[model samples]
Target: MPVTLEEAHELIARAHRRAGELGSHVTVAIVDEGGHLQALGRMDGAPPLSAQLATGKAASVALIRRDGAALRDMQQAWPALFGQLDQVAGRPILAGAGSLLIRRADTVLGAIAVSGGQPQHDDECAEAGLRGLE
Candidate 1:
């Protein structure tokens, strides 16, 4: 199913709540299948850099339609190609704040990326948000 604005809002809200519970502020970004930004939210305490990273992560997932971790692994296995990817917008990054592809029944609707906390915390927050979609 295509991601609706309401779904995006709920994902954002869930991410916000998870961030608060984890005691970490974060920036959350959602993008459509075409890697277009659908929604973005930056918590008050989140670092400015998170805005870019979050957006990039979301774009990466939307474009690749794969988990960010798998992309990272691919990059690690081929540094040359990965370096080339760096020159491109919405490739992949090692920043690690839970960037993921949003899927429903094998259909990639979009992506969600979170940043500004520990990598694991970011993943947790993103996962929490994605879970709300179900």
Candidate 2:
């Protein structure tokens, strides 16, 4: 089942809090099973580029059903396959602070992406939000 709007809002709120705690500003994105955006949050100080990056990362994770970074590594290992992946409508996964896959056991529910801060900070914020869902 897809994540509800309320759930998405809570997750993004948690992410915002986490980013604040870490002294970072971030952009958070939630994408549904079809890789369509469900919600987005860009902290006041977050960079403008974070919006698109977060959206792309979330879409990539939802579409691939895996961590965006892992997919990016796979793409690097197989240029031909991954090269074409970038053109596959949400294939080339973006890295940095934004990009996470949301799953329940073996079932992938959706994805979340966070950008605008350091990579580790972004990752931690994303993780913190996901943890709230549990």
Candidate 3:
């Protein structure tokens, strides 16, 4: 099933809480299966650039149906092709540690990403966001 807006908000809230636990401010973004922004949350102390980065990372995961780390590997292995993907998708695609594909029972619903913390911290917060679905 597709994720509901309420669920998206819950995910953002969980991510924000995780960021607080980590002693970091972050921006969390939720994108639909179509890689369209569904919701976004920027914590009080998050960097301004984190907003765009979180959205791009989430969209990359949603459209690619893969985690951000794997996408980073792809970018490393095929820089040219990966560069072309942004143009092809008409959206900024960034590979990093903060993004995850949202899935349930083998069905992909969307994706979530967190930014402004350390890469590992961001990844952990993204995971927390996914746990919101549970």
Candidate 4:
């Protein structure tokens, strides 16, 4: 099943909770398997660009079917190819620490992303968000 609206909101809430514990502000974005946005949330202290960044991260993960960490590896290994990736996503495909593929069993349901904190903090928040699905 695709990620439901309720699930998206829950994911955002869970991410926010993790961010709070980390003493960080963040923006969370959830996207469907087709790279369509489902829901987004940005904390007051988060960077203004965080909304767009979070969305791009999530959408890119969905489109590429890879977690953000792995994508970052690919980007580092092939900067020339990754440079042309924006045109493919119709937006910047940020391969940052906080984006991850949302899966069910072996099925890819969508993706989730968090931004506005240190890479490790953002990654932790994303992991917390995924727990909402469980």
Candidate 5:
């Protein structure tokens, strides 16, 4: 089944909880395998642009079926190609930390990303969100 609202919210909550534990505010964005937004949650003190950053990160991972770290590496390896990706994608494609794919068996369920914190902190929050899935 595709990711439901409840599942998306749960992911946001867990990611937020982890962010709090790390003493950071963050925005969490969940997107379906098709790179469509499912749900989003931004903490009280999160920066406004964090919402956009999280969404782009999540979409990048969902669309490519690759984690953010790998995408970041590719982005670094091919700056010119990644630089022009926004035009090709018709949306910002941010290849950064804090993004991950949600999977069941060999199938992808969706993707999640966290922003408004250090890259490592965001990565941790995203991992925490995944751990909460049933």
Candidate 6:
């Protein structure tokens, strides 16, 4: 199923709520399957850089249809190839800790990314967003 605007909003809300619970000010980004930004939410205290980081992470996960950390691992293992992809991808693709593809059954709906806190905290909030969708 394609990700709906409503679902995107739900993802942002859930991620924001989770960030609060974790005592983490964060930026949450939701993107469609094509890696287009659908919705974004930034906590008041979150660092400004988080917005860009979240979007990049979401786009990377959506483009690969895989976990963000997996992409990070791949980048580490193949720096030359990963660097080349940046020119072709147009948008920045950051392999970060808090990106997750949103899938339903066999279809990839989109992706979510959370950033600002420690890597673990960002992942925790992203996980909350995923659980909220279920």
Task: Please give each candidate's TM-score.
Answer: 0.91, 0.90, 0.96, 0.95, 0.94, 0.95
Name the candidate, 2 or 4, with the larger lDDT value: 4
Evaluated with TM-score, which candidate comes out highest?
3
Cα error, residue 102 of model 4, in Å, equals: 0.4
lDDT of 3 at 2: 60
Model 6, residue pairs in steric clash:
none
**Model 6 reaches what TM-score against the true structure?**
0.95
lDDT by residue (5-103, candidate 4, tens digit) is 998999999999999999999999999998899999998799998999899999999999999999999899999999998887788878998999999
lDDT of each: 0.85, 0.84, 0.92, 0.92, 0.92, 0.89
Model 4 error, position 49 (Å): 1.0
Q: Give RMSD to native, each candidate.
A: 1.9, 1.7, 1.0, 1.1, 1.1, 1.0
How would you encode candidate 1's per-residue C-alpha lDDT over 2-71 as one tens digit per residue? 5898999889899989999999999999999988899999999999999989988888777766777888
Q: How accurate is candidate 1 locally (lDDT)?
A: 0.85
Steric overlap count per candidate: 0, 1, 0, 0, 0, 0
Give the clashing pairs for model 1.
none
User: What value does the lDDT take at residue 117 in candidate 3?
Assistant: 98
Better of 2 and 6 by lDDT: 6
TM value for model 4: 0.95
At residue 14, give the lDDT of candidate 2: 94
Error (Å) of candidate 2 at residue 2 is 0.9
lDDT of 6 by residue, 1-134 (tens): 56788888888888888889889999999998989999999999999999999999998899888898889888999999888777889877788998999998888988999999999999999998988575
Give the TM-score comparing model 3 with the true structure, all chains together. Answer: 0.96
